[model samples]
Target chain A: MIIDFHAHVGSMDSIGARLTADAMLHAMDAAGVDRCCVFNIFHADAAFGNDLTARFVAAHPDRFIGFAFVTPHYPEEMEGELARVFDHLGLQGIKIYPPYFDRTVEDAIWEPVFAFAHARKVPLISHSDGRDPLVNPNHGEPQMFVRWAEKYPDARIVLGHAGNFRSGRLSSIAAARRCANIFIEICTSWREIGSIEELVSGAGADRLLFGSDLPLMDPRIHKGRVLTAAIPETAKAQILGGNAARLLGLAA
Target chain B: MSTSDFPVFDCNAALGRRHNRRVAYDRPDDVVRFLAAAGISKALVYHPYAVPFGTMEGNRFLLDAVAGHPELVPQFVVSFAVDDPDEVRAAAEAAGVRTLRVFPKSHGYPFVDWIAGPWLEWMARERMALWVPLGRNPEVDIRDLYETARRHPDVPVVLAGAHYSNYAAVWPLLKALDHIHLDLSRFDAANGIERLERHVGLDRLLFGSDFPEVDPKPYLHYLRHCGLEENGLRAICRDNLERLIAGERAV
Candidate 1:
């Protein structure tokens, strides 16, 4: 029951991630992953990305769980887009990239999206980094999620990448500890040793979810991180799929 | 083949502690136990202290720490600014050290030929491998690395800690240079290992964990499932590094 909580399905030539449905399926099969929550964070046009995600989910609904991508850049259309993503496209969750939108997660423009997720009882996953020089660290800092989780207690807000580095990971753990609704998704090139154990110890294993950032990163490696962690088997089971299954409302 | 069956020899691992983060395995016994748990047979270890502190002290500490642990091979850190090249070479010979790591960015030195030429020449002559990590702030200048490796063609220069973001820069260097190799600690690009195998062949790819900073199991698992032949896996997981340490050029 390995469900990758984070992954992307569209091509972003800038990052050399020209990922397709077949490629995702091939990677998942090779890594022995049962399912993945696929989205497109690179798409500037939110509807276009959601359509692509919907198409992937339609093609392989059993294996791919579609998550809708929406940006705060289109403020007026955000509510309508959320409706289309949920009612029309039948996407399960929401994905946000604050760096791409050039807006911090704590900005006023995101209130509508957060409200929508809260109303729908759907989970929202956003890109979060800790002092990364490549992107504006404030755009998706783990600490930013604390206020959002406090504001919308019902919405499950996941800090993607768990702040990326150690400082960010520590911030993420703190954020998760502060708010039960805020979860941590572990997936980054910064494969810090003892990170999983730290996350489990700091923010209970139930709050941690497995993610690969697929088509950019490998699922095998991320899954191997959980499988080989020095934590208890029950914690590993929860982080690997049980927690994600609970979040996605899927039978584990 | 299963990942456990692969004869993994980590080429880029650090021993000793750093000030910034709490390393789980700083002691030799802890490193050995950690490696065994991760299914790693051997590791070429350097001291994490070498980057912040002087290489002389760090290298000495590393040699003494791994004295009783045969599985932990000592990889000395060297800096042209800090130590005399001739003295470093003499000590390396005395210690029978086969590999050396350099931190140009952290040590605040340019990795150009003029500053590094003497060391590179000795390394080339002795058939010793040079390890360059890309994990530092501001990173190792790709052009400087290219020039250094190009100048020292005989030295088997290993570029370690290169993440997938470095693909566009690193892939070309590997393609153009036969002596250049990649350590698979942070090279987590999707299908990256397969792509590297296709472009440069498995001979230039080496297995590494960047341990105490990174876990080894994920990398081992990645290699086991990366769709390579057993021989290719063997080359990357163990044979290539074994060859590099033994001063054998890539065939």
Candidate 2:
């Protein structure tokens, strides 16, 4: 069973990427991915985007799992949105993209979101990329997430993209090693020859999860990486689905 | 059927020690060995140190390091700021260098036509290929590459290491330029390769792994499962780059 822990739904005009449920289903089928954790793509209305995700996941519960989305800029509506997503929509996790609001995961605005994830025992995933120096350089740094991991000790915080740059991969590994709560999701287009090996060695196989960033990235790329990595079969199994299954409270 | 049925030819690979502690395959032999083990039969490689340091030293290091391995082809790194255009051209010709990569951003060279005019002319005359690893810095923008390609129509230019962020600008360039080619290592956009193949011919796309920096296995899988025809798959995985390299004229 393969579980893609990172994927986006809805249209992102900023990057010219858009994916509907039908398109994602086709992509999943093509890549042979069993399940995927789907989330919103930071549209104009965060609440509406979450509703779209909820409906999409509800339509295909067996194939898709929903992760709630909340724009931290609207702190007043965050609590209500979280409640609606979890209680009404049945979304399992929280996803925060820093670049959309130009705020880091450790920013004061995200404290409530972090606190909620800790209390609920649901994993929190955030977009982390160290390559975008031109814009939002410090927003997704691995060190920032490490600080959050230390602060929110009980939260299962997964750093999405695992630092999507040549130099950032080391930072992700180092950050994951520094905090046990921080798990690195291996996604994005960038993969150092032994990046997965380094993650396994530093953070253990249980701390690494497979993510495709689908619609933004090809699922085949991430699947192929795990399948072809020099790591043991046990570790590969954990990365592909076992780790995510445990996080989502699903049967292994 | 296994994905390893066809041998791959990676066009953008790097060798030697890096100043940063990121790379897993730092040694030249290890780069070749790992690529071969990953089912890549041939690779065009450049030394990583050459981009930051003088290109002359890096080129020499690359030639000497891959001397024993015939499957590992040497791609000389050239910098107009450090090396004289005339001397570098002569040396490249003498060294049997068919393909050269220039890092304008790292080497502190402007991407204007004047700076690259002589070198571009020399490459065009020699029928050699010019590679630019774009999007590393703000200066190495895709627009500047389009301008360079516009200036030198005869030169076969390959843009390597381009990310999806530059695809917006790259789209127009793909439509306009015939001399332009793209390395498929960082082609991560959703259905990007398919889109590119539709918008531009598959002949303009070349297979690359960004080896030592990134693994070749996943990219090999991407090409295999990319849903292209058998001939299109062969062209991208091997034939296209082979044709580009074969265009290198000794005279």
Candidate 3:
């Protein structure tokens, strides 16, 4: 089964991304993706984003997996928001964006979220970019996740975009090597040639997950990277869906 | 449609190593083998050296690298700041180079008409296509590129590595200019290809991989499954580039 580990639903006017549930479903069906992990990192109110994600997943429960988005901006609301996301919303994972909050992933403000994920044993995915001049590279660098992964070994820490560029990919691979809890999601505008293969070889296929950064990127393009990577079918399968399935506790 | 059904002619690919990261395939033979494995029938290849190193030597290196590989078409990199326009034209003619790429930002030259006019004018005369990468680090200024392409309307300029972030700027460029084209390597905006087909039509879109920096198969898969008609698919995946390289303006 093909599962996209990253996707967004909502109108991000800043980036001109407006992905409704219907549009996301159409894209998923067109790309032959069996399931997707949907979230909204753009909404400032954590509950609003989770509500949007929950609504998107509720429309197509079988085909969509809802991931909760919480920010360090509302330190007081983090715990309660996460509980609502998991308990009431029935969301499976957590999504964070350090760049948007203007805080690094390792900041003291995110400790509660990481601690919550560890206690819940749910996956935590965050946007990670290295050396991208467009955004502050230091905000979401993959290396920052190593500390969290080591601290919260039970929590699945997926580096969204796998650090994005070359330096970021290398850092992601290094972080994944250091922590078994760490996973690399391959989705970025930077379609660096041989990146999938490099990620697999550097961090192992089991540690890599396929993501499209949907509504802003195409799933077919990211899926094609895994399908055409010069790797074993087993490795491809693992990266494509098996790893994500294992993280989300889905059927193999 | 399966990927094999479409004959892919990658219009933007590089054939040498860069200083930043290790590429999977850098040699000509490896690139050919890789592209063949990826089901690409043909590719317009430039050297990474051309951007960082001297254009004349880089172009020479590119010619030497793709030597005897019919599948790998030579794409020379020209810099008006470094190489004289006449010398470049003469070399391109001698080498039978049909496509020329420019890195105005990397080469430290303004992409103005006065600086690039001679080279672009020569390209227009020869019917050789010009490739400009918009998403590369230190991106090509869209305004400068717009002005340059506007001044030299005859040059079939292909914008390479343009991703979704460039949609707002690129959309107007496509609507305004018939000669301007977009490569699909990094144009991965959600349903972007379909949107472009509906708004701008498929004639201005061309298939490119930015290979060795990007994998081509995903884009091939994207084009095949993106809901375009077969004729439109053919235009984007292969024929459009052939037309542009042949100096035919968009219909």
How big is the positional error of residue A15 in model 2, measured in Å on the Cα after superposition? Answer: 3.4
Tens digits of per-residue lDDT, candidate 1, B1-251, equal 87578657999889998878777789899889989888897999999887887788889999899998989999988886667887888889998999988888888889999898988888888999999887434347999989878988999989888776676788788888999999988888777776777788889899998887887887887778888888888898899999999999998
lDDT of 3 by residue, B94-156 (tens): 988888888888898888888888878877888878888887452478888888889888898
Give DockQ for candidates 1 onward, in order. Answer: 0.62, 0.54, 0.62
Query: Per TM-score, what order, best first?
Result: 1, 3, 2
Q: Provide the fnat value for model 2, as a fraction from 0 to 1.
A: 0.64
lDDT of 1 by residue, A1-252 (tens): 989999988776545566668777888888888999999766668899899889889999899999988877788889998898899989999998888766898898999888888888899999999876666547988998888798898899999999998889999999999998999999988888888989999999999999999888988899888887889999999998999999889998
Q: So what's the TM-score on candidate 1?
A: 0.93
Per-residue lDDT tens digits of candidate 3, residues A146-210?
A: 88888989899999999998899999999999999999999988777788889999999999999
Local distance difference test, candidate 2? 0.81
lDDT (Cα, 0-100) at B180 in candidate 3: 86
Mind giving the per-residue lDDT tens digits that candidate 2 earns over B126-245?
888889886534337666777877999888888897776766676777789888888988877766777788898798898888877678788777767768888888888888888888
Show model 2 residue runs off by greater than 4 Å.
A129-137, A140-154, A163-182, B1-3, B19-23, B80-82, B248-251
Model 3 TM-score (2 dp): 0.92
Docking class of 2: medium
- Fill in the DockQ of model 1: 0.62
Candidate 3 global lDDT: 0.86
Which numbered prediction scores highest in lDDT against the true structure? 1
